[model samples]
Target: MLQSSVTPHPERDRLMTRTRRIASRLRDLRSAAGTLPDAVVLLDHSQHVRWFNHAAEELLGLKRPRDRGRLMSDLLRHTELAPWWIDGAREPLNDVTAPGHPNRHVTATLLPFGSRQRLLLARDTSHLTRLEQIRRDFVANVSHELRTPLTVIHGYLELLDPEDVPELAPVLDEMRAQSKRMGQIVEDLLTLSRLETQDHVADEHVQMVPLLASLRKEAEALSQGRHTVTLDVVAPIDLLGSPKDLHSAFSNLVSNAVRYTPTGGRIAIRWAPSESDGATFSVQDSGFGIPAAHIARLTERFYRVSSSRSRDSGGTGLGLSIVKHVLNLHQARLAIESEPGKGSTFACVFGPDRLLRGTQAAEAAAAGVPY
Candidate 1:
């Protein structure tokens, strides 16, 4: 064997020092993240557990080395979680009981990270869930309690003849209108409470043609020859869901279009196939358009773009909230598009699974119009 003497490169020492500094900083970051209260778990592309924090062990019963590299579904053992974790469902699962700890509830959220990696975060939500339950119970009870008195008051007012007291006729009319508005608010609250209890809609096919016709009539009646309300149902296909729920949602949108639009504005209701191969029912109005800031919170109960305008228009403010719940039950979503001072469009997008196309729809597809 021949031996050769070689000198070390000048940059070798500098390179080693830089590499050590980077590694030290990474270790410090990892340690800091491990101490967070929320349980954090990192999964590889195959959904095998890659790394987890101390909080994960305490909250999820995951043990180092034993649970490492195990599939999340195998460790969590929740039937519904796999779809949510793999299919990219945006909503977080709430009140998920931890393994061997029924009392400890958590809300879990999954986010896709670098490449195909996933980050699973879970936070204890037992206290928040309890608070939500209490709020729901209180709202349900109060709404139910107010219904009887409101009905009685409305009935008594109806019995009193306006012609009998001509001098007080205007006062009686105003009172009657205000009472009806209050009754509507209470009824809407009850509807929201009922919807909250349901996970999904019953599988009953709803006729779309008749529903659209009825809604158009309602919009015209509410408009009273003010706005020009038009219905352009490109695909008149039946939907597999509760007719009552769909009607309420559709009617609320029509009514809102009429209520918000100016006297000479145009309101167009359209039902057409979306570019994504789904069906969309949209209500577009050339009204005093909503501000961008208010669009996000439109579905919140009693939320209004302008409180004064909402009150003046006799809006219960629960209309959009009810629409949201109805769409959720039907496995649909409400998309709002608006531009201030121009117009607004509220579209309910339903997955293709909910559509039931008939021969007429095929003809409509060929002809490119539905009468």
Candidate 2:
């Protein structure tokens, strides 16, 4: 009777074999993940912790069984992480202090996986953060140290008359110009350093109308009647920021346009409303436009699109870098659009929180009328 019941089932055997292979592969994957230096956490659709690796246990203080099925936000308890997690992980949260290891700084990123699951990855960035701080400190110290010497040299050059040394007049003039440029460079560096160290700018009512007018006047003065410079106030909205910092940023954009645009070229400065109720200060110039490749790196310190051209234009190559730092402090962004031979546009965009509308304009909006 037992021998009669013994029958071969090939399909069933193959199915069992395949199941064993799948389980083995999953184990291998878990082992590999556990060995990774970066913290790896698997989450369910609701962002509850499903599983985590050894690194996650050490870095994020996620204990097995105890942390399983717990909400990620509840465990992390970071204000910045909450917004980042809720916003569908649009951007990474940098310099996050690890909950488990408070001394460790981590950059966290989230990515969607199969079956509505997600993966949270965090990498230690403490070393990078320290290195960046060191760089900033070095720049600030060097700039401070050089200021007095530069001032002395510039003053002595100013005292010397070019006419007194007629044979060496050209040399004297060139030396004076270069020394002046160096002094400006040092000032800009100090400004940039200060901006870099600050997390926010002073919240002051920045009157845009007069500021824009002043910027236009400065641009015209810099242009020296060589370019057609105009200002259009499309939106009569002010901003809440440090007036001095805002002026420096706006002036950099306007001066760049004036310096780069050829004679008889058109440079238009416009203050207008942007998307999401934000305000934008844009400088559009019909000058030699930047190449696509060079535009992304324009804000880097001492970055030059054309070294000879920049030097001929008397640019210290730090204007855009300073502008970037100033805008960052003001919670604004710089957007640059350019096409070769056609033109270029540099726009400083500020969020709605920074906008300050006049009382009349606010009343007009409430009455459904354009002011």
Candidate 3:
């Protein structure tokens, strides 16, 4: 390999030496808050613009090197952003002009260079806007999802005053189950948010016996008289991360299997040393498997492969999202394999180091998960 040597310039050296002090003085004089948004621009005495930053290229979708030395008019040629270079107005413009329609919003403003030239500072707000839209859609989806269940529960209650609806007891019970599922979803959402906002790292070691036991118990209860849940291993499994995080992750996977699998179907939880430097906990079930096209998006928040079935099965739709995030916190990862009409397998692959060493082995063996 050949190495190239860089030579230093005296004049450039002096300029670099004084650059910081100059920038500091300029920022102190300006009232701009926080860090100025990063952007790129070009300008000359007349209407020419040279080049700018990578952010500028992305936001404006223009090639800098190719468009350099081009006229500002040719660059923003047909857009309202072109007139933003004219002298006199320093105020920001919030315009989105089209053939006849225009958008309204203000976020960034343009500024002059030295004496005559100027540059436009446009911040990329598209991501933020998309996030807002997702938030809106999620709320609407959740509300729409819960509406039917809520209505059914309400209708059942109204039609059968507990004492009067002795004949409709079964329907009332079903209504109550749906209402409770919705409630569980709401609660899980809160838990997900709280976990994400926390700074919990996967390095936090947690005693796994009780947590896993409780999770298995919860799964069994949810399974009720459906599948016979079985634990493939014993635990006191000292998970090398937050007990809460691991439990939540495993619980979601197991819960989903139990929820979707038909009655009398077998649900198995297996834990064992998996490969070098890792342990694996897998949840297997004889449930309705996911279609090939939908497997990739199964973890997406609120993304349900089977809308009507998701409703019938009473899923809050945030279960996998929670599992995904919780595993991220534990430094573990999820691997899903499924065949439509068969069943699915969700494996929580934890790093071997995250497993308890020495006497902790006994703990893990004793605390094995209940499949």
Could you arrange the candidates by TM-score from highest to lowest? Answer: 2, 1, 3
Candidate 3 global CA lDDT score: 0.70
Q: Across residues 1-371, which tens digit of lDDT does each residue of candidate 1 receive?
A: 97768877769988999999999999998998799989999999998999999989888888998999999978866644556666654888877676666777787888998999999998877788778879988999999999999999999999999899999899999989999999999999999999987888777657788889899999999999999989998966768788888999999999998888889999999999986678999999999898899899999989989999999999999999999999988889999999988989999999988887887445544654422
What order do candidates take by lDDT, descending?
Answer: 2, 1, 3
Candidate achieving the largest TM-score: 2
Runs in model 2 deviating more than 4 A are: 1-10, 100-102, 360-371
- lDDT to native, each model: 0.87, 0.88, 0.70
Candidate 1 wrongly placed segments (more than 4 Å): 1-31, 76-78, 89-105, 112-117, 162-167, 359-371
2 or 3, which is superior by TM-score?
2
Q: Give the TM-score of candidate 2.
A: 0.91
**Which 10-residue window in model 1 sums to the lowest lDDT?**
362-371
**Each prediction's TM-score against the native?**
0.85, 0.91, 0.55
lDDT of 3 by residue, 254-365 (tens): 8889888999898888877676768788989888898889988988888998889888877889999888888877767889999988999999888866788657656555
